[model samples]
Target: MAGREGPRPGGRSARVQASVHGAVQALMTRMERAEITIPMIAVEAGVTPSTIYRRWGDIQELLADVAVERLKPDMQPVDTGNGGKDLLAWAEQYAEEMSSKPGREMIRDVLAAQDGGGAYQCCNFTKQQIDVIAARAAGRGEAFPEADAVMDRVVSPIMYRILFGEAPDTAHVARLVSGAMGLVSKAPASV
Candidate 1:
């Protein structure tokens, strides 16, 4: 059943993607990310190995897709009429998620794949969240934080600590977010 040309919307391709995605999540619960193989996923997904290879190239790519689908922050940016407070809330949530067990595992897997010379290509999910917050702030006539500054001041520190030994607590995250807000507030608005 491999004679189809390009992807057909709402067809077998979508079904396969869903199945594979589900299979990855399911397998992750039982095994380490590095231990999960394409063949194992293929069996769990009920698709052929060739199908997975053709669609995703490798386990790293498939895992990246799965991470994007499942590991993204669940809440939208909060708008409390105060840009700094809104930003702090969002950053705290982001940090908390990244410090969770599943989040740490996902990051370890993705980073391992990348370090192992595999093409694990998920964009910075935190950056996307920051952009949404910035847009909302701008819409409300509040000073929008620069995405880079947020990443550097808030996201980077949380991730660094989490990935290393000590995951920061909520109090620490609040401080980090507050520090980031200070940096953002002092900068001139982007032209």
Candidate 2:
């Protein structure tokens, strides 16, 4: 019958998947531009409202995934032989990148979704960055028990200040990097 559950005789499944993907992409674009709604997205994608709701379960999950996808690349730390230098450089780059207009806007949108009771993708994204950094440090006979806390101290303030117009000092970054390294240096090596 070519209804919701049943497949069409032709390549309707593939077509439907493509349509859904395109619709999500378009809706996300509109979200970036500051205009986002289910009906508006359905109209833009030329899909029935129920289709998107049915396929994705809801708009929040879809948006959260998209937000997480966008933040993935920025969370990677660069290796520069020296951990402090590398960490500082990465922090500087992150601050610069996230402080930009587009980056700030994206952060705002992502935070909005989170505050509205959706899943917070930022935690997972930051966890990935911390895992990478901690693994590298561990391989070099270092430990980072407080890696997540350190990252929060170094990067979160900058992001928070930028997004909410709060004032945070530059020395905070220095302290965070140094404190993280100090903890790492104090850990015993494996025999």
Candidate 3:
């Protein structure tokens, strides 16, 4: 998975990835994590075990890649008619999701992959959501911090508390979002 850039837009590579990812997801639901293997995924996906290995390198990387794909947001964050409220709503939802049991497990799977591509993909997922929030705010003529600053000020702290220490409560999340919103009132406009 080191040099791999992911599947092509449409081709055998994309089909193989989608099939393999679906197999992993399906297998995870039906069997214990320890019971899964490259051969099992290959059979489920109707592909050869070598196909999985050639694309993902190993079972760990395959699982990590699948977890990152599962973590992608299917829809944009909620819009509350106010930029500050929107940020707060998104932060609160993010805190809840990341602190959940499944979320923690996904994070661990991503971290287990040696190449770190899964982690980068997961971070991009968060950053992309923040960018949407910033864009929405800007469209409403409201000022919002750059996506990177919001990540630094709001997201990093929440993730730290989620990954270490106690999971932050709503109040804690509120404060972080408040500070991030205030830190750059006249900040640039969108992501």
- Which candidate number has the best lDDT? 3
Cα lDDT computed for each candidate against the true fold: 0.75, 0.61, 0.88
Top model number, TM-score: 3
Question: What stretches of model 1 exceed 4 Å from their correct place?
Answer: 1-10, 30-35, 73-75, 114-124, 184-191
Ten residues in a row with the worst lDDT in model 2?
1-10
Reference-based TM-score, model 3 = 0.89
Best-to-worst lDDT order: 3, 1, 2
Question: Which residues of candidate 3, in runs, are more than 4 Å off?
Answer: 3-6, 186-191
Task: Tell me how candidate 2 scores on lDDT.
Answer: 0.61
TM-score of each: 0.78, 0.65, 0.89
Q: Deviation in angstroms for 180 in model 3?
A: 0.9
Number of clashing residue pairs, candidate 3: 0
